[model samples]
Target: SQFTLYADTSSRRPGFSKAAKPDLAVPLYEKFMARCRERGFQVEHGEFGADMQVDSRNDGPVTILFDTEGNL
Candidate 1:
């Protein structure tokens, strides 16, 4: 449950100001994680604003992206 900032840009470079500020985002994220735990999930996560090295060896998994209108 790593909450990375949702950054986007019109051109080639990236812009990060679109993501929710930590002051607001962190509390909501914490609430969500708490709900998941309350539902008996064994959740593992990283720091909210820290760089982490994630290593995975699993086979390919399906990935999807969507906008607010639900179109990819």
Candidate 2:
């Protein structure tokens, strides 16, 4: 069995100049979801341009971060 998580985030919005950051990400996000579905991934996502909130808990007091800027 395999499991993975995905999130699409952005910080831009056009046309509706009064919009906020991360507003123009819906189209890109939808494409991602479609591709994942085609690849047989368990799909779970909110509607495009919808406000969302997420929470998480860790098992221990240690956390690690990865910077993939130039790893390729």
Question: How much does each candidate deviate from the true structure in C-alpha RMSD?
Answer: 4.5, 9.6
> Per-residue CA lDDT of candidate 2, range 1-72, in tens?
011123222222113444434544556666778899999999886555555565667889896443344342
lDDT at residue 46 of model 1 (Cα atoms): 75
Against the true structure, whose lDDT is highest? 1
Best by TM-score: 1
How many pairs of residues collide in model 1?
0
Candidate 1 lDDT score at position 19: 84
Residue by residue across 1-72, what tens digits does model 1's lDDT show?
543647674545557788888899889888888999999997777788777777866576864343544344
Model 1 — TM-score against the truth?
A: 0.62
Stretches of candidate 2 exceeding 4 Å from the true structure = 1-24, 59-72
- In model 2, the Cα lDDT at residue 60 comes to 94
Cα-based RMSD of candidate 1: 4.5
- For model 1, the superposed segments whose C-alpha errors exceed 4 Å read 3-5, 9-14, 57-60, 65-72
